[model samples]
Target chain A: MTPVLQIKNLQVSYYTDAGRARALDGVDLTLTAGEKLGLVGESGSGKSTMALAMMRMIKPPGRIEGGQVIVDGTDLMTLSEQTMLKARLSKIAYIPQGAMNSLNPVTRIGAQMVDAIKAHDEGSSRADIDRRCKLALESVDLSSSVFKMYAHELSGGMKQRACIAISILLKPKVIIADEPTSALDVVTQRQVMETIDRVQKQIGAAVILIGHDMGLMAQFVDKVAVMYTGRIMELSSVRDMFTDPKHPYAQALIRSLPNLENKGVFNGIPGMAPALLQLPGGCAFHPRCSKVMENCKTQRPPSTNISGGRILECHLYSEKA
Target chain B: MIKLIIRRLLFLITVIWAASTIVFFIPRISQKNPVRERFATLAISGGFSPKDLEVIIASYNTKFGLDKPLFEQYTDYLSSISRFDLGVSYNKYPRTVLELIMDSLPWTIVLLLVTTVLSFVIGNLLGAIAAWPRAPRWLRTFATPFILLQGVPPVLMGVLLLFFIGFKLKLAPLGGAYSTGVIPDWSSLTFIWDVVWHQILPGLALLLGSVGGWTLSMRGMGITIQGEDYVNFAEHKGLGGYTIFKDYYLRNALLPQATGLALALGGVVVSAIVIESQFGLPGIGRVLDAAIRSNDFLVIYGVVLFVTIAVATLMVLMEFIYPLLDPRIRNE
Candidate 1:
């Protein structure tokens, strides 16, 4: 079946005074309907950039160099801005990071939600919109009175849940959540993640969960993709990624997670990810990989399918499968 | 909200009382006393004997309440304020301070109200437009002239406008609320038209002088709000450009501008002074100038008290209404 969202060889870069930073070098991601894909990466790894690029919401200085963001069957890159705006909430919705603060402070929640709905469907009546808004709030376990309240009146967790409700209000085919719970407490994070999970399932929408926490991603997502220096290092099922991560960066990420089963000092990856402006020649992760070969430094590692749908991009994995 | 209004009302009353007390004592504490100054002018005219002059001076002092003890005078002043009695003008005897102020107040109110609202609307609209992402290069270029205009003092602007537009081009009347011979009749369009025509230069001067600061401030605020995450979310929600501009961006950006309007309203009296004096309009500022030169204590105190109460009332109203405009402050 055709994927709900297919991003092919996406290239996005930020033009700064220093240099052109390759935010998304050559990202290729596909999310089928009802699929939950977690994009795991450290800061500056371009995970958030990919999310923004998917939504076509990249700000100035950050340009979509070349790419095809095909949602359902339509090529979003080819659509005009007017059409793209219409496509945004109806075709795909984005629940941005820092969801707590991502709301117009002066407007009431219901009014803002109605604005979102009416932006695409101007024919929606006030009564109908109000009903839908209350329904959306109720689905997130929020009281209907939250509709009358302003964004600042709500707690952080409520704000986040309100953001979730808004994203799924239209039941878009795909929802890109960029670090939705990173700013939340552990318990609130779980609750938010569960709400996202339940809403995604109920609406049958594909989700791209962008985050740096491997443990949380493992618990939340169906598939995991490890990214480093604007490239995906590994893509596999959550179970396989947790048990046997092929890529060196993925392995380091799993090792860094504090394991209660084995009490020991957590070992983090050595050195930082290469600057996007001046990436190392060949595999970007080679500098931090312990099992780095000479070829890993000189030649870019190509993705090789291991088994089932598992894929790895590393010189060491070349001879293993 | 009612509680907030009541609290603000109480605060406003206190502020107005304090300002009134200060204004009431200013002429008293000054080296030149109104009664003595009048007596000096009379003495300079040189037509009276010393004994006769002393009797006239004592009677003048009693009539003006200057003969009373200081404490009794203060109580009398306070009581007069409660009764809305501002006292007779020191220079224009037989004419009360209230009558003089009433005659000039309408002209100043018209000039100030028109110029302020016009500048506010034009400035904020221009600022919002300039800050829009798709704003044309020419629209952004609008900022340069406004920024330069903001740096130019209101007096200079008034003078320049008076010279170029009023004198050189002769496009508008230079001074007064109306022509010298025109009767002040509301029923006649010609008279009303002449009044509006007379205000053009002064109004333009005020508008051009003040529009820049509002434009600059609103532009800065607009640019900041554009970068906010909610704006991005609004865009992602497929909000149309106008909806996002009006609801998300402009609504959030206008909070600071609203606060600015309140503060600007407070400065209206001060701004009017320079503009009014420049245009030679029969406003409170022109009256104030004459009052200052002649040491008209009652007129001075009354005008200051009026301005103080107006500003205090505006601030109190803004303090109560601000939360309604910006829900973020509602709980606080």
Candidate 2:
């Protein structure tokens, strides 16, 4: 079956005073129907850039240099702005990071929801829009009374759930949730994640959960992709990723997570991710890798496929392959 | 909500009462005496006997309630005010203060209300257009002149407009509400047109001097509102440019401007003073000016009391209406 979303060799850059920063460098990702994929990385690893690029909403000084954001079969880059806008809510929905500040404070939730619905389908009657809005709110376990309330009236958790409800209102094929639970408390985070999972199941849409919490990613996503310095260092099934991380960065990230069972001292990755403006000549992670070799400093590592559909972009894996 | 309004109304009454009391005592505390000043020329001419002068002074004192003790006079003043009886004017004797006010109030209201509302609407529209992210670069450049114009005082603007537009171009009448021969008749179109024609220069002066600040404030607000996350959410929701502009951008940007509008409306009386005097219009400003010159304490107190009540009422009204516009304020 065709994937719900496919991003091929996507490249994005930010034009700053210092120089052009390669925010997203030749990244490729695909998600099949109802698949939950987690993108984990440190700050400035281009995870958020990738999410924005998928929506084609990059502002000035930030440009999508080259890419094909294929939602089902449509190439979003080639579509006109007007067409892209129409395609956004109907085909691909984005739940942005900050739920606390998302909705317009002056407008009622119901009015704003109706605005989104009417933007695509202007012919929709008020009763029809109200029915759908009520259903969407109920799906998130929110009462219909919240529809008349403003964003400030809702708690952080409720706002996040409302945002999720809005994202799935049109039942788009792909829902890109960028750090959806980062701002909530632990309990609220779990509840919101459960709601997202339930809603995704109900809608049968693919999910791209972007976050930095390795533990949460391990529990939530079916597949996990580790990103570093604008490059995906490793991609594997969550079970394999947690038990046996192939790339050194992935291993370091997992090692840093405190394990109650073993009670070993947490070890963090040495050195920082390379600055995108002046990236290292060869492998971007070479300077921080303990298993680095001379070839790692002079040449870029190609992706080598391991057993069980796992892929690793490291010289150590390349030699074995 | 009713409780809030009631509290605001009580606060407004206290403010107005304090202002009225201060206005009533200012001329009395000053050394200048209306009765003595009005007869200064007669005394200098030495045309009356000492006995005749004594009788005139006594009658003037009785008429103005100066013969009574200060406390009794104050109570009388307050009681009369409660009864809506503003005393007769000292300068324009035989004419009550209320009648004089009634004559000039409509002209000032027309001039101020028209100019203020027009400037606010035009200025905010231009400012929003200039601040829109997709607006052409040249559109922003148009705001520079208006920004500079904000520094020009309204009185100076009125004089400049009187000199250039009224005197040099001769496009409008120089001063007064209408031509000397035009009778004040409601049924005559010519009379009404003549009055409006006379108001053009002064009105334009007020508009030009005030529109700049509104534009600057609204531009700042619009730019800030554009950075809000709801704008991005609106975009992701497939909202059209117009929908985002109206619903997200303008709606949020208008909150501060609404407060500014209320404050500006309250200050209309203060602004009208300079514009009215400079244009030589027979408005409240001119009446107050004459009262001050002749030391007509009753007239001065009456006009100031009217302005105080107007401003206080407007402020209270704004306090009640503000929550309806901004939801964030409602909970607070």
Candidate 2, position B272, lDDT: 82
lDDT of 1 at B112: 97
Per-model CA lDDT versus the true structure: 0.87, 0.88
**Candidate 2: which stretches are off by over 4 Å?**
A261-264, B41-51
Across residues A128-207, which tens digit of lDDT does each residue of candidate 1 receive? 99999999999998999999988888888899999999998899999999999988999999999999999999999999
The DockQ of each candidate is 0.82, 0.79
Pick out the ten consecutive residues of candidate 2 chain A with the lowest summed lDDT. A259-268
* Cα error of candidate 2 at position B240, Å: 1.3
Q: How accurate is candidate 1 locally (lDDT)?
A: 0.87
> How much is the TM-score of the A chain of model 2?
0.97
lDDT of 1 by residue, B1-332 (tens): 67866887788889878988887777677756676677677777874346676677778889998888877988898888878899999888889999999999999999999899999998998888788886788877786687789898888988898888888998888787789887899999988898899999889889988888889988999899998999889988998888888888988899989988988987988888888888778899988888887788779878998898898888877877888898777665
